[model samples]
Target chain A: MTVVIGFEGSANKIGIGIIRDGEVLSNPRRTYITPPGEGFQPSDTARHHRSVILTVLKEALEQAGLKSSDIDCVAYTKGPGMGAPLVTVALVARTVAQLWGKPLVGVNHCIGHIEMGRLITKANNPTVLYVSGGNTQVIAYSERRYRIFGETIDIAVGNCLDRFARVIKISNDPSPGYNIEQMAKKGSQYVELPYTVKGMDVSFSGILSYIEEAANKMLGSRQCTAEDLCFSLQETVFAMLVEITERAMAHCSSQEVLIVGGVGCNLRLQEMMGVMCKERGAKLFATDERFCIDNGAMIAQAGWEMFRSGQVTELEDSWITQRYRTDEVEVTWRD
Target chain B: MTVLKRLGRRRLPIANKMAVPENDDQASKLEFSLDVPFPSARQAAVALGSLSPDREPRRGGVHKRLTLTGSVLNVKWRADEARVLRVSVNSFLDHLSLVLETMHAFSADVCEDPHVVLGHQPPSAT
Candidate 1:
């Protein structure tokens, strides 16, 4: 049984996960939240990861009931993420690998999400809608590669929601996206926002700007409430996402759609995607927060697959990067 | 001082560490360590980028490394003379403050403003 420990601090969330032979032993995560009206910055998020990583690692080991020596390997996110956070987690991963005399596997952040979703949902060869603060794409497996069928041309869907939450000074505790999701439920009016879908890509910055201006102008005149804006934003963005995913689905002729990443946890998105899938007689596959958000278990799961395929990263070559595209990785584990 | 001496004694991989010389006085290594956390590792790296250009030729008795551990800016400096260490550290802090203030100002006035996100404005330019 190959037991692997994975460290993920690619963004604001610091997660430590342990997995053994395709099963999750333990997955612990911590998110860094800034004050209201503030978006996340990379450096501060990296500090939060550094501060809590040891503690999270200890908890993960304890919960898994395994000593550091019991681990066969260490895995970390080598990303398309903020550089400092990626390096911070990579540093610990390297230290742990050296301290334990184990092999190290640097996993791609996007593939981690996809692999975990597949593991949990058991959906094989599904079209994927991977959405998060830093990324937005519609992907599908083709010729042993997770090919990007469509993507965002500007700010991601989650970034748009989070920035909208900031415009109204909402608490960012769990997430600005979650708060906006809640507010959206109470909205009685559906304020019109830009719905931009260009070919296989979508753009949100325009809608974000339009909403911000709408909030200011409408709120000043008492024509719309925050709830209305939130509702409109969710409806508009989710529709665009669903449309893009459906386009990818039609192109691939696939029957399953898997949603992964932090923003994939949104119920509204899932519902919209579900409706689209149902209309087309397709299935929708998604996992809860534990696997959807950046977490160690996903990394470990992906790393274990890579490790089993003899894809270990040498110590000197484990330097983390910020622009690792999803398709850049050679999917050796998959046929 | 003790930490700096220990750092001096420890043999770090050449790729990761640079050595600082101790002049004739055999003075105890004067060191400065500052930990500044940004909202994300990208911000910390950007701040590091602002200070890293000055450390290129590396021949001075003072040694400095701008590292981002997670999202924190870790400024580690060591020098044979306290004055040299202080000056370098102050200069780094000045650059750091400027980077941070510029980030804040950008986020406050332009980046966060409706007009910025609507376009392809880089954070540095903002």
Candidate 2:
């Protein structure tokens, strides 16, 4: 059994996961929750990760019940994330690999999400919609690369939701997007928000700006409740995403559609995608919070695949890349 | 096991060597020094390799150096102002704590000496 230990701190969530082959041995994570009306900064998020990462690592090893000798590889998210938090994780991953005498693999955070989704959902060669606070893209596997068919030209769909949550003074206890989903569920009215989907690419900054002003003015004048605003926002942006994803699905002409990212767990988005998948005669594969959110198991799972294909990152070349893209990696593990 | 001599473009002799050339000036007066104790010398070196890769691109007002003597990691920082000094020190401590905790976990189960892992042979085995 090939065993891999993964470290992930690309965002506010810091997770350590141990995986043996296709099975998850252990996955433990801690999120740096901020107060309402505020978002986490890079330095603050990094400090938080530095504090809890080792504790989570201890828990991961304890739960896995694997000796150091059993581990075959060490994996870490090499980024497309905040600089400081990414560095914190890379620092630990580098040191631990040295200490444990294992080979290191630098994993792309987006590919981590995709691989974990595929492993958990068993969706083979599906058109993937990866939406997170930092990224939004519709991807398909073609010719040894996950080619980006469509993506956001401005802010990501999840970032729009998060910034709108801040505008409404929503609690970030669990997550801003999760809270917004709950609020949207209670919403009765469908307020109109700008829908800006240009060809295959989508933009959300204009929508976010419009909604921020609308929420402030409407809340002040009781034009509509925050729930209504949330519902409107979800409906509008998810439609934009669904439109582009469906366009990608049409282009790829694939039968399966997989949703993978922090925002992929949103019931509304999943439900919306499900409708589109059903209409297009395709399948929708998604995971719950455990696998969907930024977690270490995803990284380990991806690393396991990479290492199995003879991919090993020399420690000196394992720098944390803040803008590592999804299409840059060669998918050696896949057909 | 690779030592990081290329934090910048240049190379150093040691595996875990990264140094910014010393600049002594009146403006660079704010200085701080810290000694972080680890269980072993190799662990300190691992900490050094782990933490020192984040060299600045001259955007900040801080300059720093990391060196390992025995099991203690020596950190000396010279910044242009007190604010820069404080920020640099705090960031260093945060990284140091992470390294220490990682050591606490793996140092017991894994061989304390990293060369053993790299060489794939215990000293006794050799």
Candidate 3:
């Protein structure tokens, strides 16, 4: 019975998760919400993370009802995130590992999502669609690696939605993306938008730019409502995601499709992917808001897999990297 | 002498260095020091090892060096401007605070002088 504690502050959210084998004893998180018309900056996000990281860690421990001695491994998101926020969490993880005298496992953020999804949904082998504010990729495992079959050529799908959210000046109380998703529910009109899907790769920047201009011209002119704009944007971007995901499913010839990331909580995206899965005689696996959004539990789950496979990060190699790729980590834990 | 209870942050602008603008128009000539206290020399060295890596986002504009003096972790920084110095120092403080708190929380288990901390200096560095 291996117990692991993981830290995640790679983005706007800072979370701590404690896992004992396949069971999550506790997972607590805090998100920094920015005002409307503004996005979170690296420094400000790190400050927010620093302020509550310890409290969250304490809460995680209390919730899990576990002491420091119970934990066998310390895990943290190592990369593929903002530099400042990534370092903020990695620093704490390193210090804690030293104090607790446990082995440190530096986890890749995307792999954390995939591993967590697998654990929660019990999807033995599935093609993964990883879409978050920071990344968008369709991945499949082959020969000891979660190879990237397709990815964003420009901006991520969630970034496109978030930038459009700012254009609309929507509330970021919970999240700009969540607000947009709610607004899209009320939208009836489907204003035409650009659809850019090149082969297996997808691009969202051009679509975002076009919609930004269209929203400005149309919103002030009383032609397009914010809801309609949101609906149009979601339909376009999610359609692009479904297209590439389905293509990856075909390429991998897999029977299951798993959606993992902050944006994976979107019902519309899941519904769309579900339809594709149904048509292809495939099963769709996705988690709710609790698991879909960035959390320390995901990192811990990924680290648990690696640690059980006899992998641990040395103190000298625990520094965070902003651009670590998904395919960089060898999936030693997998068959 | 009263030892600092918490890590103290101090920034000094080198007027002489600023008078010449060492490298091009913007040379990070500002410097700051952060002295973080730990329960043991071993823990102080652990903090140094944990933070020594990780290069700054912008090279040449900012530089950081971590050294250990017994039970205190001494961090020195050099930067091109007050803004640059503030950014780097702010980040360092965040890391240092976490280290101190974690050490304090787990104080019961850590043994004294268990491992040799790599970056150790004489008390003169203080």
Candidate 4:
């Protein structure tokens, strides 16, 4: 039984997971929310990583009833993230690897999500829709590569949500997306917003601006409730995404749809995708929080696969690449 | 993939640790300072073009100037106290490359007598 410890310090969430063979022994997560007026501060994220990484790692080990020495290898997110956050996680992983004398593997955060979705859903050829704070893409596996069928031309979907949340003074409690989802549940009227889809790419900036304007007008009139606006926004955006995903699935001729990334946990978006998939007689796979959002287990899972294929990064070979593309890396085990 | 290799090369340290002598002719000849923050690139060009009233090497050449027509941020570098290095793009690609190169060279002290290449636009005939 090979025990692998994974460290995830991407986005605002810090997650640690312990896996043995193909089973997840323990997966615990902690979210670092910026105080009410302050947005994502790099220094604050770094400090949080330094403080919580150890606790989460220890918790994972303790819950799994395994000693530090019991771990066979270690995995951590290498890049496609904020530099300070990635550096902090790298430092912790490097320290742990040095102390434990275990092989350290650096995993791509995006691919980790895709692989984890595969692990949970057992989908062989699923068209993936990965939407998160930093990324938005429709992916399909082909020729041993995950090709991007569609993606955001400008800002990410989750970034748009977070920015809108801030604009409306919504407390980013639990999570910004979750709060928006809750507010959307109570919303009634659907205010028309710009739905801009160019070719396979989508643009959210215009829609964001339009919503702010509409919200301001509503505020001036003192008529529509904020919940209704939130609901309308989610409906419009999710419908746009579902429309694109449906197009991609038709183009790819695939019967399975897997939604991964932080925004995948949004029930409304999942429901929209679910309806589309059902209409097309296609299967939709959504990961739970442990694997849905950023976490270490997925990194370890991908690392183990990479390790078996003899893909390893040298110590000097490691560096944080903020714009690392998901389709750039070669995956050997995909058919 | 070739683009990635070119990007990697551009990211490498430009020079090793060797400070530009204070009195060096070239060092004294060039003027370096941070560019002004503009609400957008088009607005900045309009501002700068109005202020200078002379043909200057538009930032990042015609392509970038065209690309950053409405960009929110841009970096302007002046070399040889004459040419303006307009490093602006719709995306962060060129800006990131320039910043990384500058930091690496500055740290290594090898960026003293740097040669600035103006992209796509020729120097204005004064």
Highest DockQ among the candidates is held by which one? Answer: 3
Model 2 over residues B5-108: C-alpha lDDT tens digits?
Answer: 11111212222222334555544366667665544467668888788767753779778898888866788776667777777777776676666566655666
Q: Residue-wise lDDT of candidate 4 within A1-335, one digit each (tens)?
A: 67788888877888888888779989888888875434687657766775676668778878989876688787888878886677666655654554344777788888889988998889888999999888899999889788899999998898888888887888777778888998898888877788988888888988889888887889679778889888988898888888889999999899999999989999899999999999999999998766888888888888777776677665545555666888888888666
Model 3 lDDT, full chain set: 0.85
lDDT of 4 at A281: 97
lDDT of 1 by residue, B1-126 (tens): 232232223323112233444644564576667666555555555555444543412566788877788766677777766777766665454345434433433233233434323112343533
Output the worst ten-in-a-row residue range by lDDT, candidate 4 chain A.
A92-101
Q: Which stretches of candidate 4 lie over 4 Å from their true place?
A: B1-126
Off by over 4 Å in 3: B1-39, B78-86, B105-126
Task: Point out where model 1 deviates above 4 Å.
Answer: B1-126
True contacts kept of 1: 0.00
lDDT of 4 at B22: 71
TM (chain A) per model: 0.99, 0.99, 0.99, 0.96
lDDT of 3 at B10: 20
TM-score of each: 0.76, 0.87, 0.89, 0.73
Put down candidate 3 lDDT per residue, B22-104, tens digits, no spaces: 56555526667766665457767777867876777756488888887777777777776788877777666666666666655
Count: clashes, candidate 3? 3
Tens digits of lDDT, candidate 4, B1-126: 233233334233222121223766645533323233332243334333212211223442222221123422233333432332222221123223322222222222211213321111222310
